[model samples]
Target chain A: MSQPEILNQAFELGYTYTRSTGPVVGRFLTGLKNRKLVGIKASDGRVIVPPMEYDPDTAEELSEFVDVGEQGEIVTFAWVKEPREAHPMNEPFAWAMIKLDGADVPMIHCVAAKSESDVTTGARVRAVWADETIGFMTDIRCFELV
Target chain B: MSEEEQEMITKVEAPVYLKYNFTAGSAPTRFLAQIKKGVLAGQRCPKCLAVYIPTRGSCGRCGVPTVEEVELSDKATVQSFTIVSIPIPNNPIEPPFIIANVVPDGANVSFIHLMSECVNEEVHIGQRVQAVWKPEDEWGYSMDNIRYFKPLDEPDVPIELIGKLTVTGEEG
Candidate 1:
């Protein structure tokens, strides 16, 4: 095939993924709907953020629900030079796993900063909200560096 | 259960539909486009002679780019098959359908396509089959171009001869 002809044949394939989150994730979303940041406390008393349905260390279902502070400290993050499809932002942004106050594990989300250099480990950030809110993760627009 | 009660509970009309936008990635787009024209195309790795259905831009084994475009035969053999009694959500086909791994006559890879014109018990490994194109009106650049594969009258081709054609990447 000719170059242009072959190039023309190349097109994008689309797919829709419908994931069924188990009870723990379902309960977490329900809590988020009430504007509550819920965590599942592990057996050792480490309250994990964005409550893990299954404990990574124990491989058991987490049952305890602990309310964590909405505010948190930036644990670590990578500068997303080019955000992939379905990411919170289309433009340049920073994705960080923030360990919320009173929570042990970090949660992944975008951090809003003027530039990558502006974001740093241990930076204090707070959740920003959209004008309208759904119970989904996108409800928190991004963390603004304090 | 009383017949009258059963009849009363059975509602005649049920409407179920799912709406979502699908984006085709790079490799599948080429495969779909060829389906629209009723042509069989496979990706040929220049270095290893591996031909892939649902052609890939690069060779998985050699990790080099495959530049050759090889037109393959529609005739293929059924390596294995399953009667799908449980339907996967969002798929175009309904349940109780036959899906088979069809290894085309001159390619290393086997593609999963619907099997038609045979009883469930009639389907077996090494069964000869040929592509049955959908009506011209319904043709598009997708695997849907060939509606399904049906039993072919040609004698069974040997595994050694079939193996000669470069096996493309693994089954999808």
Candidate 2:
């Protein structure tokens, strides 16, 4: 069979996977549950949003946590005409990497705007939390253009 | 970094589970069905003389399609084996079982299966054995058919007499 045929057949059979994120990510999830956007500042002073467990540059374990502002500035974005499975939005939306105020790096999230024209770089947005959350990244549905 | 900043961190619980669909291939489907019938089946490469257990549609070595169906003899000789103490994910069998590569009489290649009905010390290279199949009701088209391979009371054949069958060398 062709590669695509093989892939299609494989998809029909069910598979499940469970991942265990280390301590750093676990702490970050707790902060999100309390409606806080936390960042981990590296030794070099770069503050990473969605605090990573390991410093990307040095590979050292991160322990410091700082609360960041819920609002952020969109650095770059893509008009997602075709939303993929489990995306915050089911309809056409914009996915942007926004640098939360006081955080040095950007965090990827959906921009809940009616149209592409409604979003652009430097636009202010705020975290839109779900009515109910189970501590996963989906807790924050998307960011609404402020 | 300040000592006060490090002291503010605490552990938290983060549970993540992902689910997706996985489909079986045609060759594996047939293999599973045969296991349900308490039968062990292998796909024979007519051109290469290689018999693939839990049969493969294509030969890895010769790059040819294995079309000929062969009912491999239940009896085989252990070539090499490993004792699996750790659990393998999604496997139905329990841990501490012996998995071995057994070369059936007249087949050039070895097939992997559980080695049972014998003590760990009793398992050795070149020992003659036969498959102990599970009940028909317990069968599935998987290697689970022959529950395990047991030691044969009879004598083993001479190693020299067991010739390596090669497709490139001669016609079958």
Candidate 3:
């Protein structure tokens, strides 16, 4: 009789569904489609790009939209030397906290870099848009070093 | 178009995909090895002395580790079942199939498995069944080695005595 092989199985669990992105975030995504950036005013008057629905400090509904610059600074990042199949990029990249000009809070997004050493704190970067823009976060394909 | 409508995205189609790799534990690994040779085996808890098929490494009732290997027969009794009318994605078997919770003889617990080669409507609790194994050349380290359980000609084990039958032909 042959020995039993170690039981290894690969499986996937997922589903597709439609979701409503109400007012605030909807406006920000809409801005990306129009080749622009939008942010909301926080309770402390800080501009938050990819506008949140509520102010973190006051828990009040935020509606004020402020135009933000596409060029930003890398605040911090985690370097991915080897990317997984599910990751956005196949090559080495950095998942960074970027603070766009005119926005006080940093937003998390990936940065395309040739090597780990290419990314650094406080480095200047600019949004790289996709060829065709849709009202989605991927509209800004990635951030590239400026 | 109005300003509100122009800036709004009411809904968006979001598709999600997640992948995982799973490895069977040591107890099931040992059970699969014997299953590859068309033999049924279970592990017995020393504390409670109850045997479990596709052994879970420890006894659920006694909460103690089970180390004794107990050989079981393919003969089983249907403890409960459901007729699936809806199709499952990526499943080779079609809908309207029988999925049963069956207790293999000599084992104290019931495990879920597919039942085929029998009438779907006639399947019921206490129905006698036996494993329908695939060809020897097709055997592997998976439960798919036994394609499915089919009806057996033996008498139905009484509802009260269903999973209590021991390996030595005695009722517990």
Candidate 4:
């Protein structure tokens, strides 16, 4: 008797998991949903954008929330000539460590620019909110040169 | 963060989807070869003497690699089972099916598999069963090669041999 053909099947794997974002992160995501920018004061009174629950160096608790401006300066950036699959944008963009107005510390985010020549270490940029905000880090779709 | 904002922070619901293909490790690679030839291979732990089906690289109890390979008999006993009536998504079988932990002959530990060729109500501890394989060509490098364990129409496995299959059960 002839042998039976090999069996092969592809399956879809999915899971739905809900978790608490905690007070600090929840407040920041809520701010993004409302098209507002917010940061938290670190242990030593240094404003840390994209708030950390505890100060990294001192390990002190952080809770004081401060409203920050949407516009910020690109303290430093890396130009992506060829974007990878996980990159925010398909076209060439720069991943910048931005220091938003009124915040002492810089936060890493992607900045949209025409080319490497258009992006600079001290270039000013502003947050571009998504069309429909759902309280996610991706809510700030991407930053654009101001 | 203010008290009002803390109160407003509710549970965040997010559904994750991912796809991955894993390479079969060395032990699994050899076990797959045996399954392709319609055989169930097991590795025995030198220290604990536990027979691990689909041969594991190391013995959990001994913490040593099993160098000897042994072929296990197709016949096994339904040492334990559960009648799953809940309709869970991604469940291979329909509701009200029996998923059993059957100890193949001469193997110390039991292997979990679906029990076929017997009514859900008839499946019980010590019920003798036999591995029913798919067509030879349909065989693959997975436990799927054995479609299911079916009734053997024989007496229950020996009481002494059945031993303490369950950890919570008294020593046999």
Candidate 5:
């Protein structure tokens, strides 16, 4: 007839650390700070956005950097109907695999849209830069449907 | 662009934070209900007949369901313990406190709890201890109902007979 008292508590797990991003990743982050997009040349000559330090197939050290376009097409996406507190977007959004212009490989990022119907495969989207561009992935706030 | 803006970034500080709301399960809820009344309770496995305080709803050794309820004694014996010198992150308690793994009479399993009101260096295996509970008004569905354990005046149980005691506090 009466509800039993249940035990509950809020818990927080944290980790704080500093690390060196080395030349390749550091260069890509630096490009974002400068309001530019950078990609690396793969062994097969395909350009990879969010550049890799080495070619995955040949395992060769990659040094060539190519400037890629800010606009891209969504390859696929998962729509978040109910956003959680940890999500980048408070409102409903989509985490999409985007193929930027001039880059063969697609990068995963969040996209802001009015509704799930607004997002589709091959939908064109452009990067929305933050007011202050720091050398971090958050420099590009989120992509918007173009 | 400024020269500093053109300079390459090398290092980054990444701090991660996670939050969650934890809820107690059925077995613990039953145990905490009794704990709110200043009692310790456990579940006994049907297959192994081993009692566990704050029961896991199943026997760890026998893999059988521990459905039979058994009330345990607040008096316990220190099976093992550690005197910490380094402070834990975000915890209010300072260093140099004793944390012990204590097996209560009638329970085959041991649980961790703070040990206080005794010389840290003097705390040893098979030491007899009793729960030092907080005020009745402050009691809730939490292990914190007992502030800490203190040394009891009773003689220490032998090291080999630590968890092998009956409900009446006799050798099992």
Candidate 6:
């Protein structure tokens, strides 16, 4: 029997594709990567966090970017008793809708808290970004109680 | 593609996580069981009589349920074949390997499998091939039970009869 030629090839069992984030959402997230926050003004003059390209009610095109503050008040939240595998936090935490200093409507994200007893409707929190910030949703690891 | 046209499309990369469950129905359950036991199984349609290797539990032609389970031979006729050369990430096999569709005797539908044993050029569309199974101890509920199909010493079937697996007058 003769030995066959062996070749070294690189392969990975994972997804390989590039997605385009349009100019509007792209700039807003780019701000987060730079440790800065940005918002967009809606047609009725309401500032929106995680900016939208169009006003939902008026169907108006929105582009004016507004710089928002890092600190925000929790509008409403659901406390996790036991975290699911998919949840961002493994320990007891709260998934909250936070109204940042300059935004009109709230943005939804997870909050890191010592206990469920610590979080409340009007509790103040600030963004605690990941050690290495990239233009990713997880770049904001979670908000910590301020 | 021009540089300005390329600039129009911005590319971003991210790792995605997804989870789901597969529900193998009664017919596929039977098929998997046979593979685990080191055998090939198919079901015969009651009306059309066309056999399905991984039985859909119903015949596509008559929409009639297939109930009679039939044992199939490991040997098969190569229906189609292609040699892949371009390297793509996550490909299970390396470049220059053959991916072919082979229909086992008494089975009407063709199933995809890897072809091996002979050098690249000798493989033909009507080639006679037999399943080269993994060691019996390693058999499980997967088509991987048969690692690949190897060329047979017998002559290739006539060109017109090459791809046909269903018996005469039973064509669908």
Looking at chain B only, the TM-scores across the models are 0.75, 0.70, 0.88, 0.80, 0.89, 0.84
> All candidates' lDDT scores?
0.75, 0.74, 0.88, 0.81, 0.91, 0.81
lDDT of 2 by residue, B1-172 (tens): 2553353334334334465565657776665655566655678777777777767677888989887766656777787889888887667878788999987654567888898878887777767788887776766545667778998886554554332423221212
- Candidates 2 and 5: which is better by TM-score? 5
B62-134: candidate 4 lDDT, tens digit per residue: 8999867878778887778999999766666788877899877767778889888888887888888888889
In model 3, how large is the Cα lDDT of residue A82?
A: 93
In order of appearance, the predictions have TM-scores of 0.55, 0.67, 0.76, 0.67, 0.77, 0.73
Candidate closer to the true structure by TM-score (higher is better), 4 or 6: 6
Regions more than 4 Å wrong, model 3: A1-23, A30-35, A81-86, A115-120, A132-135, B1-26, B63-67, B82-98, B117-123, B151-159, B167-172
Candidate 6's C-alpha runs over 4 A off are A1-17, A55-62, B1-16, B20-29, B56-67, B80-89, B96-98, B116-128, B150-172
The sequence of per-residue lDDT tens digits that candidate 6 reaches over residues A5-93 is 23223433556666777877777777777677789999889999989989978988888989999889999999998999888999989
The order by descending DockQ is 5, 3, 4, 2, 6, 1
Which is the winner by lDDT between candidate 3 and candidate 5? 5
Q: Clashes in model 4: which pairs?
A: none
The clash tally of candidate 2 reads 12
Worst 10 residues of 5 chain B by lDDT: B1-10
Question: After superposing the true interface residues, what Cα RMSD does each candidate give?
Answer: 12.3, 7.8, 3.0, 4.6, 2.5, 10.4
lDDT of 4 by residue, A78-128 (tens): 999999876799999999999999999999999998999999988999999
Q: Would you list the clashing residue pairs of candidate 1?
A: A12-B24, A13-B23, A13-B24, A13-B25, A14-B22, A14-B23, A14-B24, B32-B141, B36-B140, B108-B167
List the candidates ranked by lDDT, beginning with the highest: 5, 3, 6, 4, 1, 2
- Stretches of candidate 5 off by over 4 Å are A1-23, A78-85, A115-123, B1-26, B44-49, B57-69, B83-89, B118-123, B152-156, B167-170
Cα lDDT of model 2 by residue, A4-107, tens digit: 22322222222344556556775666667666778998878888998987788889988788889999999999998888776668988998999999899999
lDDT of 5: 0.91
**Model 2 residue B94 lDDT score:** 88
Query: For each candidate, what's the DockQ?
Result: 0.03, 0.21, 0.53, 0.33, 0.58, 0.16
